[model samples]
Target: MRRTSARSRISRALAVATAVAAVAGLTAYQGVAAEPAARTLAAGSPEGYGAGTTGGAGGPTVTVTSADAFIDAAASDGPLQIQVNGTIQLDDMEKVTSNKTIVGTGTRGRITGGGLNVSKASNVIIQNLTFSGSDDDAINVQYSTRVWIDHNDISDAYDGACDVKRASDGVTVSWNHFHDQDKNALLGHSDDNGSEDRGKLHVSYHHNWFDATTQRNPRVRFGNPVHVYNNYYYNNSGYGVASTEEAGVLVEGNYFENVKDPYHLGEADSGPGSLVARNNQLVNSGSGQTGGSVSTPSYSYRLDPAANVKSIVTSGSGVGHV
Candidate 1:
């Protein structure tokens, strides 16, 4: 299906709302329908955006406490503030529009049972939410730009906990926790769909806690120059980072504990990507395979020692009080 523009979608939604109000002889509802939300958010900065990206600015704040309300708010156009005050369990994927800030109010505000899909959206921020038992990916970013997924607890998904593909760029996935899950994260899905994902899928993953995930801490495919740093991996039953499809992955400053296979350039050297591993600390883990070099990250961020990564991540990563 052809993607509809956010403005056009909003216009249609407002028109429907107005028509409904008119049919009900409630004209006053039109005056206060889907107004611009007001929000103060730091812009997203990745891939040449110096200070990061901005999202859903100058809009009204909508506090959603149920699945239907959350879906309604997410369907609306951006510059929107969506505050989740409690759990919103869904039966399907919720499409999030452009320029949106979806944050949890506290530790208990979470999205469970279903998931969120951000496709063809720009300037989105998702933070401080716990997602589990989702029928699909906990959070999927496809063909999106300037997205930040931070401080969320994602696990037990039917698919990947967090998956980024389909030419998504300018993204940062940081400070999250993944435990007791398989197919933890995937940068690119299909090896044949390289036209849309070959030069894109630029993402920075840092300070995430991968605990007991069976595999694919992040299975990379055709995502060149993926910056993965300062993450804590513990008791991983499967390999940590697999760089396949000629992707250049810079895996650095991470702590791997009791992980059999930490990092590899490709699956048994079958693919063509390269990996650069340096200054990392490993305990009871296989030495990661490294061959190729990747480009450095765009912005400068503080990274603690590999020895301190486990402690810092265990103490700070995941939902609640982030």
Candidate 2:
């Protein structure tokens, strides 16, 4: 039993009507700081840092200055804290696998003319960096799992900014800034080829800010079952979030300052099935929608009542449990 928002409201009504329960908790999505985890992949490599074994147990606190040497010498174990005193070129293809952490030197330091391509990797973390004048995706994830991308600024990507593809699962993107891209700042794919079908795929986006000055393209492509939360989108020349086909989706707790919606649901297909939306603050945005599906928000808590709810639920509520 999946309970829709209507059922949740009805349950509240019934409880009020019969006085069976008092004050059903307001169903709201909280923000997960994901900040500490944002710093490094983990603490120490209790298991030792290597490419095969889950990379490092945590992130290494190592610091580097050059992008050329950092990519060549970086290991999957621990955080690779590199400071870019000057501009670095990323023309060489780099492979990040297992749980590796890559943090840029200064936010002002820029990575130009290279692609941070993720291929067949898992548990990868990249943040606090900037990419400009990249011919391809500044960041790309393929056949990966458990990826966390936050707090980076990307722009002027001739192709796209970020792309998630090839049956990737358990991805969380938050607190990033985007500008001047040809496609979504965040994109997902259930299957890269037509042969593979969607069996299990889950992704989440939170607390991102987007500003598009040109009419290049939109900000998000929702290709899989995704959860979009608490983001601030503005000056988008295109859609905020859209889907190529039907997907299980949830859009909630977002603050849209100025946007244009080609579809009310931000999708080309009728829309995704089992879609849930609530508490989304939209201002000066279009309300065009498409598709057919059941979408609502804040109903999971109402369907099954539980005690000590905090343990079972974790979000951006000043706590970090991912």
Which predicted model would earn the best lDDT?
1
What TM-score, computed on C-alpha atoms, does each candidate reach?
0.85, 0.65
lDDT of 1 by residue, 1-322 (tens): 2124333444554455434532432111211233233334322333332126666555554556666667766878646766677888889888998988888877876898899999999888888888999998899989898888888898899998999988898888888899969989998868777888888888888889999998888888887788888999999987899888978888889999999899986664447587898889999999988887787766777777999999999999988746
| Residue range with the least summed lDDT across 10 consecutive positions in model 2 | 28-37
**After superposition, candidate 1 runs with Cα above 4 Å error:** 1-51, 268-270
For candidate 1, the C-alpha RMSD (Å) to the true structure equals 6.0
Q: What's model 2's overall lDDT?
A: 0.50
RMSD per model, one decimal:
6.0, 18.2
Candidate whose TM-score is highest = 1
Q: Global lDDT of each model?
A: 0.78, 0.50
Per-residue alpha-carbon lDDT of candidate 2 for residues 1-322, written as tens digits (9 for 90 to 100): 3224323433333233223223232221111011111233432221101112233233323333445444543333333333333466777446675656665554444678876776777756666677788877787777777676666777887777777666665566655677777575544453234243263345556655666533312323334446666666667766666644445456656665567762244344333334455566667777635445533322131211122221222222111212
